[model samples]
Target: MIKAKDGDFFISDWLRNVNTLEYLSAWETMNNPDFNYGEYAIIRQSSGTNTFKISVKEWVLKTNSIGITAQAGRYGGTYAHKDIAFNFGMWISPMFQLYIVKEYQRLKTIESDTLNLEWDIKRVLSKVNYHLHTDAILKHIIPKSTLPESKKGIEYAKEADLLNLALFGCTAKEWREANPAHAKNNLNVRDFASIHELNVMSNLQVFNSEMIKKDVSKTARYKILLKSAQEQLEQLKKIDILKAVRKQNSATYIEARNKTGDELEKLTSESILDKNKQALSDFNKKLKQGLNYNPKDEK
Candidate 1:
């Protein structure tokens, strides 16, 4: 939300309280140094509007917006939920309300584009380096002259999670810790990952696979890999994304133990306007050199 004239901008859920009288009184009192303390503004719960005035404290308690510094003063103004703020803006001017919506939507587009660029870089990096990791598996983890245990792919599954753990310092389950809107949210902490972190993670997959068949105990292997991941990721923690695209292509991709031909093909995307797209492609090809899946033939 933005009130350019008032020089206010905040991004969070809008606040609207149908059961309380706080909003109206607060709006009415804006910019008033001697704002009366006995005022309130309660919206009708049924209609979600139709506000009526009441006592201030009751309004505060009912709406749960009472604060240490009750009113927004020199520090711009009292903080309110986006909804309440929008309501205030509307009260201030219909033109202000439209401005708020326009500015908010514009900010969202900028945020979404920035996030997609970051995800694309990570996704592309993951693809290019994938074959290297898989090659490590085929050359080291696979049994020699024998088929390994085939009861279930759990061991292989664990290795895949290990790759994830190495790269991101957590399993997919851990990735979802906040359980953010799995798809609804377009940007997240993961979206902020650095290119260096993604690179280290790709190499770690190969390193983990190589260790799996080297008789290194899982505990020892995990510790080594985790330590490497931690130390490397430490560098990325400081990445500056004042530098950091486009549509998400409306499809989600899953991390893999192994990629199918179709999956690889699906991963390829049309180039954005970036001049470096070809370089990124060549770089990707080198990364996945030894992988079994052929991205070009993927559906």
Candidate 2:
């Protein structure tokens, strides 16, 4: 994806650094083995003098920076975690790095608000829908005579997988394969699933639970569930994306002000991440539901 190569910081020589070119290349290399390495290596080692191998082991030796790395083989390339990437970004261009940090911080500011709003909304909606999925599960998963709390817990886990499969288009293991962008190779779509998808997932799990009892095969259920998820996403595409983003942004600002209808400044007084940032993700979801979302369908 990196058609251009530029170094902002030198892992060894302070003169070289990382930038957008590095981030994109690293992402491509990790996801696409056939990624144009001949093109990328030049970029990876483009530092005029600090051509140290991008190996994690090598980097530690060179700069004592414990993070940032270069991997090799069909599934390897240079990668830095967010912290290291921030360092690399600064190393590449001080102002550019600052901008990167600022923009990223902005995104996170927005995203964290989004995440918290999502968490709260889930807490609210789930309280009511918890039994919808669980009741069906209890009947299907338990023995007729007696049911234990432990057994109900087991049933929930299975139902959760079914939910993962429906909206995520993958089970837990499958999501990692599809999204190797993980810091730990364990990325679940739930980690970043659209509020709409998560909402639909709750409904799907119940639907899937019922389907399971009807003796539908897993493959059939998977196909049906995926179709349902896609259809739901498609239905929401009727709205304008930019408009939705702005509307949601406004709602987020207000919620942060209201602090989810609680004491605003005091409740989140210690958020070191974003000073005076607000919570509006639930508003985003509230507005976007049946109107817009799920990037897979956005395009």
Candidate 3:
């Protein structure tokens, strides 16, 4: 009761300032549908005079203001909307307003940093899971000594394409053909994949590894993988962090993993671009040879 009485006295004295009255009137006009503008104008006219004064309760009743409220009993005091309260704090002390704004910014930065860390952890996990999936294929899925000389290589490409089809709705080759410019620039489909897709892909890699160990048929595994991909991606889409992740496009590439014997290598964009240039030069030479052939020369 004593605190509430003190709060009422503070608010009444604050309301005696013409600027404070205008600020409150603006807040009420913006937020309260039923705010009494006629009463507000009369109050504004009489503000700043020695005889003029108003308590939180009187302000609420006269102007139908929802911005300020007076409460009684336990946990009771004069309360205002956060914006209004902040403004009132500034009216009393500028340092209080500065501290509030700085604290708000600090909390927001912490939230952003936490989200970025989560994304980096998930991306790293996906790459680790991919290695497991590849190892499973090498150990359990591919034949050791039974393959013919004609099919000596390209086993890894086929296994990778199966995963590409399940999550990306296209084989790696098909994606390359559809997006010629990106392919020419050495950009893979996974390079443009969203955070949600990468997260789901990580789960699918683990599932694939276990299925391969159990001798699951490619067709059966693919059907299950595709269904799981659709469901998981849809649910991840609804997460609020996804909006933040999407906005951060510049930081969103999954590092490419390459293996040689027992060593694992990370492929940088510059290295990929150099390879693309060499490949294009070789292709143009072969195309020129084909294009220059003439029937007369053959005869």
Candidate 4:
């Protein structure tokens, strides 16, 4: 589009204008912490004169600007931030600028849709396998007549926490304590799990289910689950799925509802199981059947 408008020459014309320079300087100020304001001031003072001319390269070198970049190589080209690029497009013509904006929005919508579809597919697969895991638990792990109605979910929580510990190095309760803000919103650890983690977790569910059917003890099954989680996670890390997809930004969504930066950062980071000593001890005791099972207290 720029080539058709003869923008190659227009770049210098664009830079000579005081308005263009001011916009570029303002963008740099906002985005570039190390922008050389002293040099920018000198350039601004010299603006709007026939004698005043600056190339993209000259502007970058003079002001430590990051709003635009120039490189000299086969893949090299003058690139500007979207704001500056759009402004340059407007310099070409309003119609051209409109086209760029619309095309950008179209592409972004397609990208967002594709990512959402991918995430939904992964989530569905995880849910299906989770149902299978729970079914196996019902048939094999939970005793039908040996426990009361209120205690049935205790075994479910225990098995679920077993997978949680294997994959996340934490129990469900531990995850909740460490992420109180998310807990307040009724979000769980898996709700914030990355695509790769979800994929590995889906497989872990199947493995755990099969082991349960074979009457594997909790301790024995946990060792196998942990090994599989680590190995699968390491292998999945080599895949490029993370680049194409991200954990749904549920944390960011929650943060947007008047949450602070500190809480947002904490939400995004991994929660250590050992962060709360009391919770860890409780989890250990539960695993050893030392704590009374309470289905009403299910997380």
Residue 172 of model 3, lDDT score: 54
TM-score for every candidate vs. truth?
0.44, 0.37, 0.49, 0.65
* Candidate 2 per-residue lDDT over residues 36-113, each given as its tens digit: 556455645654544433445443344333235666799976666675556555655668667986897898888777
Candidate 1 TM-score, true structure as reference: 0.44
Off by over 4 Å in 1: 1-89, 92-94, 143-158, 165-199, 206-221, 242-299
* TM-score winner between candidates 1 and 3: 3
**Candidate 4, TM-score vs. the true structure?**
0.65
Candidate 1 lDDT: 0.49
lDDT for 290 in candidate 2 is 34
Of the two candidates 3 and 4, the one with more favorable lDDT, higher being better, is: 4
Best by the TM-score measure: 4
The local lDDT score (0 to 100) that residue 22 gets in candidate 1 is 48
Q: Please list the residue runs of candidate 4 whose C-alpha ends up more than 4 Å from where it truly belongs after superposition.
A: 1-12, 16-18, 34-86, 93-96, 144-149, 241-243, 248-299
lDDT of each: 0.49, 0.48, 0.65, 0.71
Best by lDDT: 4
| Two-way TM-score contest, 2 vs 3, winner | 3
If both were scored by TM-score, which would come out higher, candidate 1 or candidate 4? 4
Residue 155 C-alpha lDDT in model 3:
40
Output the TM-score of candidate 3: 0.49
For 1-299, candidate 1 gives per-residue lDDT tens digits of 35455644332112334422345445535634444453332233322444523333344555443331234447643455555556756754679769988999999998988887777778886676566655555555554413323311123334555655445544444444444466235343335455776677676876776775676655566667877877876875676544543233322233322333343222211111111445444433543473343323211
Q: Quote the positional error of residue 12 for candidate 3 in Å.
A: 0.7
